[model samples]
Target: MPSLITPVMPPGSLNASAQPTLTIDDLLVRPWLGSDAAAVARVFQEPMIQYWHLRKADSEDEAREWIEQWRLGWESESACHWAVVNADDDRLLGRVSLQSIIMVGGQAEISYWTAPESRGKGVCSRAVARVSSWALNEAGFNRIELSHSTTNIASCRIAEKTGFALEGTRRRALLHADGWHDMHLHARIGEA
Candidate 1:
């Protein structure tokens, strides 16, 4: 594993406003909006999303709570979240987030999900790569980590393609609806 090093910028430099709209190919990764609640509720219905994330919001009101949590995370400087939208029509495709942030240590964990219709199209991978690049190069994060259930081959592929080196596995680290699952840990270091 690469050592966690502090970035040049001081902690708290990355606030909500510091986040920018990032365009990668046809996808637009931007901050989440209150109006996105309905769409978010719909996406959370996906079996795969529900299985991994371990939560579901079937109503707009329930979904708004999720968005509110993301917003609060930004205000607290504890995390950053983005809505993956279609650049042309501004349709929500999925979400990408840098959670578990330790700004003083210049480190964060990456998480993402693709809409059911958007899967197998590399949407998640592209969004993840772009966001991770920005976190390392622009936001000045020294280390980024990704973790997924060991059974999720697709997520493993995304992590590998985005330059995150597989570190090891944490047995029974996450509890899904089925049971406790072992999770693989991956990490990437910023350029020197």
Candidate 2:
């Protein structure tokens, strides 16, 4: 049996080329590097990051392991993660990722977080919008989805800013540290 829509992108398509660096204003979005472990670990230590993400890198080694997973995801065409950096000083600012990729279906889920210092400055939203556009227009994906806990008003605003339409909510879709959360589902689809 075949899917009604043929594979929009073949497996290994993303792996075939060097990941390109994307830009938004003064920031650059590039593939994660092993050397970024120290900065990544430091960011993971931030209380807000730990609270929202539910995981922390207590050591640089753990951060490196996470980086390695991103590398492997590229090789396997399962995900794409980029580190957002300050163009002038090369300071780490945040991250944007397309995970749970399904090439045959041309879809993926968007994930993102901004460094505490970069929050409230539109970094995450701009980075997410840029990455989502790239994924749809250049990376061969037709649909990209963003979901966040319903209580996360900031994320909801980002989704709206990035033009991801509210598709509805999934009750108790995610388990957080405190309890299960109903998640708001948003999606952006490329023009057919």
Candidate 3:
């Protein structure tokens, strides 16, 4: 798929005061669950997710705990974590979430991971666009933010494609095992 660019949304349609139904390329976006640990986990193991997240996580139990923790955030109303499942097969294809909500400003950050077999196919781009459009038009979110390491070009492409403008870079914001890495910051706001 071609890289995405910033697209102007309808005026007044994308605001923190409204919420739209978001549909991502026939993939149902639903809340994450412990039951989805196994399916959700397959994406975690992908070379891309592993590199971005910077963890190997060799066992299913370990991955389940991680999901459980994310689930806690959901339970506490601290985030919106979701599992992306194929509409036809209902098989979990990956996950996308609005995490670490900055409630004071009516903004939040989004994170997503796609199945290894599903990468380079525009699934991430579609999901981000679909959810971001909903977040702006229906959910009343003011801004959606994203950050990725410099080396992760694929993710950068995703952000750019989804209409998020690259703001700047956070110097050595992430301390990975290999070393510290910079985070490229990107953001998208409602149509003005």
Prediction RMSDs, each to the true structure: 3.5, 1.2, 8.4
Give a tens-digit lDDT track for model 1, residues 41-73.
999988889988888997999999889898788
Stretches off by above 4 angstroms in model 3 are 1-22
lDDT of each: 0.91, 0.93, 0.74
TM-scores of the candidates in the order shown: 0.93, 0.96, 0.81
Give lDDT: candidate 1, residue 189: 90
Please give the range of 10 consecutive residues that has the lowest summed lDDT in model 1.
2-11
In model 3, how large is the Cα lDDT of residue 71? Answer: 64
Model 1 TM-score, 2 decimals: 0.93
Predicted candidate 2 versus true structure: per-residue lDDT over 1-192, tens digit per residue: 766766989877799998879988899999999999999999999988887797899899999999999878888899999999998888999999999999988999999999999999989988999999999998889999999999999999999999999999999898889999999999999989
lDDT leaderboard ranking = 2, 1, 3
- Off-target runs (Cα >4 Å) in candidate 1 are 1-9
lDDT of candidate 3 over 1-192, digit per residue (tens)? 653643232233323232223466677776666777777566666776776787766767887888787766644545666677777777877778888775546578998888888777787888888788877786667799988888889989999999999999999999887799999999999866
